[model samples]
Target: MATAAPTPNRTPPALRRKRRKELATAVGFLSPWLIGFCVFFAYPLISTVYFSLTHYDGFNPPSYVGFKNYDYVVTKFPFFWQAVRNTAWLVAVMVTLRTVFGIGIGLLITKIKTGAGFFRTAFYLPYLAPPVAATIAFAFLLNPGTGPVNHLLGQLGLPQPGWFNDPNWSKPSLVLLGLWGIGDLMVIFMAALLDVPTEQYEAASLDGASPFQKFRFVTLPNIRPIIMFAVITGIIQTLQYYTQAIIAGQVASGVVGNSGQQFEPGFPDGSTWTVPQLVYNIGFQRFDYGSACVVSILLFVVAMACTALLMRRRAGLMGED
Candidate 1:
């Protein structure tokens, strides 16, 4: 065989041409997404990373500062830690409450025998409201003075705590607003609950499992994946929570639009300053794009880490299943 000089294995010209054409077709189909990803996502991410290392205002050329931005954000920024705390509270308390309320509503809806469609529609309508409008409406409704809710509380001889205006109640007000718009999560949970095998429930029932036992052992296990999904998404959403919090703060502070003055975010003693709001304030308001990018990078990292952790835990749970 060595003496004979082994011939090279090669495709026929026709086959080669066909393969090339197939590859071209595949590339053609993928080109749009590839171009979009590079232009939009990849470029922005790279720019952000670079900007985070530099001192750049929007107009001036970016000058490299070598982690000074990060240092400032970590050590010197007054509102940075407060914003992180507020965001963490939203991620922890708000997300958990939304998930619980969503699941509870979903279960209740699934158990309803009459006017199911009506109830579903009624519940979902709030989620359809524009975030800005909803925040404004909620803020007005809970206004400490001259709001209908306070008026009602006064009539009932109950303490009317300032909802959005009070520092202690501001985040809770946002949580309530979030819970009011949990129709999307409710729908997801309802679908997942319905998809669980009825046979599993029947088996648990036949085994003398009580209603709570069936729910715990059968229903929960079956819908665990969906719950994980909802929780993870809720976490991510709460991490980027900006619009509602900002609007609520502005409404409560009586600053509707640009008043030609520096609009301080996180009104009522900085109780509602979120990371995204901090980023906006830094980048646009103060023109400290570098520090803004640092905050954004931190946010991105936190969101990715939380999502990965949840996903890994979900995978482990699924393996156990």
Candidate 2:
């Protein structure tokens, strides 16, 4: 007996309604992020790009000037090269130091037996601290005199090094300070270390390999991707560094703009004005919106080029495998 023409297979209305409901629910969950991206990132990105090609005073309509802004940054602007040099120094050195320090810390902490948990939390605390508060703390910590760091050195009969005060050491001091809040990097490295199999270590030991040999061959290869990840992200983070440099820059000049006097060049003898800060000063402080837009577009191109080169290099390396 043929089963009554088994009902032509189709989704029931109830199931169709449920699927639609699920999609709607998923979209609802993403609504906040979607709204934020559209309003903040998407809009601002388009607007800034448009503004960069124009001469816009906040009060006036933006006037298009073709590549004049970019030309000015590349050709006429003196501080443009200075800002590039400073930003490159910070990004290159800090990214390198952060990667090395984070990996070293992760390895050492893992080596500990009984106190790893406590030390991990303690070391990671800086990353959790509000950036402004942490920077202020660093400011006090690096004060040439009266600060605890300097006071302790004096107790040891050593000269208190100028950290934030002397322009000569300010960039280096900032790089060192950057290491303090590198818990995020350390944590990422720690996870990669954990992914390494104990059996692989045992096997390497069986071959009578030294600890460094095992690390060099097995551990390093295993963790290369993680290290590359850190490098890319570190580049992005350090390139975006502003709060520290801005504070440091403003302090260096020790001058504020007024009706009577022009604002000084940069912080602490103009040693710490990274590209973004330079753009801000030119645009707002100097009232040369045209130069600011040029500086900004150049900065955008530099950042993009740096990121693309890094990512493309990585892609090539991966493809070779």
Candidate 3:
């Protein structure tokens, strides 16, 4: 048997040209993002680590402080510990609410066929509002005496608890405020709900499954990955919460006026001081960038550790979901 010589019917020139064009197009498409990542994100992250290690204010040249900043932060500074405590509390309370209630609301809204769009939009409004505006609005609403909430309490014959204005309730108020903007998380949960195979629900219904049972057996399993994502991002987001508390703290405690009213107020009653606010006070107001960097690093570690722990927990729960 003589095999004929293989014919050289290679790729047509037109096809080769098209492939080349596609390669060029793909490269062109990705270049902008690649360039942006290097210049903006990569550079700043590297610079931050450098800045963390040395004593550098924006104005002066950085001085090498070795591990002094980290040491002082961990061992010496009570304020650092206080800020960490405050941040931890915020993370603990706010993340829990954001997860539990936010997901519950998501499931409720999804299960409601009528007015689903309206409820979704309404629930999402807070997350869309500007942080400063939202914070200020909350401050006014939560005013201890004159706020409408207190007025409502009075109308109901209830003693009005001080909200943002009280030392006891200010941190709690911030936690509650954190709950207002879980619209994004809710949306994610809604999508995960939608991903639950319709057939599964039909089966569950035939098995006499109640709504809670359906959710437990069908919905929760389908949404486990997303739930994990929500948990991770929720913790990270709460850990990085700066704007609302910043505004609240600014409004409540005087920022620059400790000596004869020269400063802005932070949480009015000395409550709701978060890690970032404390970092700002130390690094900028007190001109201690080294200490600020130390606090920043500590917060970074805690946030990362918290996120990792949650991820591990989720992994273990993966079988259940």
Candidate 4:
């Protein structure tokens, strides 16, 4: 009676074989994505993280410098703090304004009974324009002295502030440019609005909810995820803001120097020099690749943190508690 010891339960050979086959099939399906992940994203991220710790110009071999690169970015880079402040402002203002206006415009277009298609197309056309061309065009139009916008403002007896020329107005002019191309976000909002169940509106109507109540409780809650998506993407894009800002800066500064001449970015007193511009100036302009990598790494960390925070809030918005 004392000698009886039971053996652990074991899976049957046939069942184990079936499970293995199932796993193999799943892996087969995931192979492409797995390969891509390792080859592209994983490899590049690892390389960047490693390079960020070393002093490596493009032509020379990398010299390991421990945390010195990070130290320089924090303590030595003159434009680092200004870039951070500008980027934060851009993210805050652009994301909020884009979300509000996109939703509002979507609602407006839906309310139109006739020529909805025409209005949608017209609004979306700006988003389709090449960013470089659009920025150049906007710079010309908003030119303080020669642009028609200033002339029209003058005729109407309104303040014709120097748009990109003055430090105070440069950021605002960039915000205006952003607003012009907000049609992509607006279209997404419109699609989300259209997908909201008509039954929900009817239910709210039967409950005698006011229009504000209906929108607040019905429309907004239903589309909260979409709004979150728009905000997060806008934040990411704002963090990487470069081309249009640079173009606007160059045009506004009127410093298109001779070929091979490097014009300083963040014109109008460093108002538009975002973090990406800082990276470009450090890495490409000055050829201090190490410091540039450090800044890039810092920006990457920030973008990841922002994305994670937003995604975590998404579950809460859906009443997941």
Query: Against the unseen true structure, what C-alpha lDDT does each candidate score?
Result: 0.94, 0.80, 0.78, 0.91
For each candidate, what TM-score against the reference? 0.94, 0.82, 0.81, 0.93
- Ten-residue stretch with the least lDDT total in model 3: 256-265
Per-residue CA lDDT of model 4 for 1-321, tens digit only, reads 588789989999999999999999999999999999999989988888888899988999999999998998998888999999999999999889988989999999988999999999999999999999999999999999999999999999999999999999999899999999989998999999999999999999999999999889999988888999999899999999999999999888876544676789999899998999998999999988888888888999999999999998887756762
Residue-level lDDT for 194 in candidate 4:
95
Question: Tens digits of per-residue lDDT for model 3 on 1-321?
Answer: 999999988999999999999999998999999899999978866766677788877689999888887787778865556666777787778877888887798889978989999999999988998988888888878777678998999999998987776778888888778788878888888887777899999999999999889888888888878878877887788777788887776555435235555443245534566677767777877777877877776677778898789888887887554
Using TM-score as the yardstick, the better of models 1 and 2 is 1
Q: Who wins the TM-score comparison?
A: 1
Residue runs of model 3 more than 4 Å from their true location after superposition: 1-34, 253-270, 316-321
The root-mean-square deviation over C-alpha atoms between each candidate and the true structure, in angstroms, is 1.9, 6.4, 6.1, 2.1
Candidate ordering by lDDT (highest first): 1, 4, 2, 3
Separately for all candidates shown, the number of backbone clashes (residues 3 or more apart, or on different chains) is 0, 4, 16, 0
Query: Can you give the lDDT of residue 278 in candidate 3?
Result: 65
Shift in Å, residue 235, candidate 2:
0.7
Worst 10 residues of 4 by lDDT: 253-262
| Candidate 1 residue-wise lDDT, 1-321, digit = tens | 358878999789999999999999999999999999999999999999999999999898999999999999999999999999999998999989998999899999999999999999999999999999999999988999989999999999999999988999999999999999999999999999999899998898889999999889988988888889899989899999999998998888888876775679999899999999989999999999999999999999999999999899888877887
